[model samples]
Target: MLSATPRTSLGREKHRGSTDRNDLYQVLDTGLVCHLGVVADGHPMVVPTCYGRVGDTLYLHGSTGARSLRAADGAEVCVTVTHLDGLVLARSIFSHSVNYRSAVVYGRARLVTDPDERMDGLRALSEQLVPGQWDYARRPSRKELAATAVLALSLEEASVKIRQGAPEDEDEDYALPVWAGVLPLVTAWGKPEPDPVLPEGIETPVHILRRE
Candidate 1:
């Protein structure tokens, strides 16, 4: 279960809140990018970046020179992932809303230093973005590894909120002639485009072609 921390508590729309830990994992695992919030140079900064999750830990990586990554190391941070499912149309304009699944996590991010763990974290990140590319592509060299920075944040303190189905309209608005329903949104992978300069004999890998 997720910890009931003050930061993770919901002040409104409590009906949409979820305390189940699995819900948090589901939201994070399905998401391809996350917005990381942190205080940098006494100002709030939110950066959109790719991430990976292993067990209860979330790993984020970027260039070592990035200011956001530098500020996040050893500092409290907030990470969020959201998936928009549909647009809910109601009889009244005020009742119009969206269906989405979102998760917010709060924790102190620590910079990974151990060589083996750093490599593992990088692998997790690579796999999260592209399943088979990590093994197929050339591994990072020593100089490349030194130029990258990885931070790990625990998922113990998190909150999840999900909204689905049709929108709710007031009783008086039900009699109105306005149409009401849901427009679902779907995401899919596009066809792979091979590099133009590559040798003609090479072809797209099975893993890339098989992705749905």
Candidate 2:
């Protein structure tokens, strides 16, 4: 686990530095998509898409038409992975914000060029989408790997910000007649639908069917 080099604000509190990065990896592994931000032609853009973490690197996959993929090539990009655990309904609307665990990873992304590593990256990307899918489905041919674009960003410059529990209201506001508690949020997967072209024998593997 590499610590951040202090390129950005760590956190508001003194002990808020989450530079261990393993925690960030854990959060990223739990979530399938991330809001990837990068500067292109002097403008900032944030694109939402799926991602996967293999050790310290975060891999983002996209199609050829995606604008974010074009901007990420050889550019310093920021990817944010967030999970909303609850909604903090405070006494005042101004004090309201979702309780979330989020990580911002900063690094110049390089388009994966190695043939061997490209397939591995694609596997990680696929597993993130549907666990056990990589092994269950046919592997990509060399030509398929060459067509897909994958970017790997390191965990060197990243930070995590979390807000949990109940809302923080002012002393006077707490006495006011208003609701102030947490409405817990959750994310879950539905039944896996098989492809229409599939042969009848295939079934959902345990990894996908049993994931918590």
Say which candidate scores most in lDDT. 1
lDDT of 1: 0.92
What is the total number of backbone clashes in candidate 2? 0
Task: Tell me how far the alpha carbon of residue 190 in candidate 2 is from the true structure, in angstroms, after superposition.
Answer: 1.5
Q: What Cα-based lDDT does every candidate model obtain? A: 0.92, 0.81
The lDDT, on a scale of 0 to 1, for candidate 2 is 0.81
Residues 36-96 of candidate 1 have per-residue lDDT tens digits of 9999989999999999998899999999999999999999999999999999999998999
TM-score of each: 0.97, 0.87
Candidate 1 accuracy as TM-score: 0.97
RMSD for each model, in Å, please?
Answer: 1.0, 2.3
Weakest 10 consecutive residues, lDDT, candidate 1? 1-10
Measured by TM-score, the strongest candidate is 1
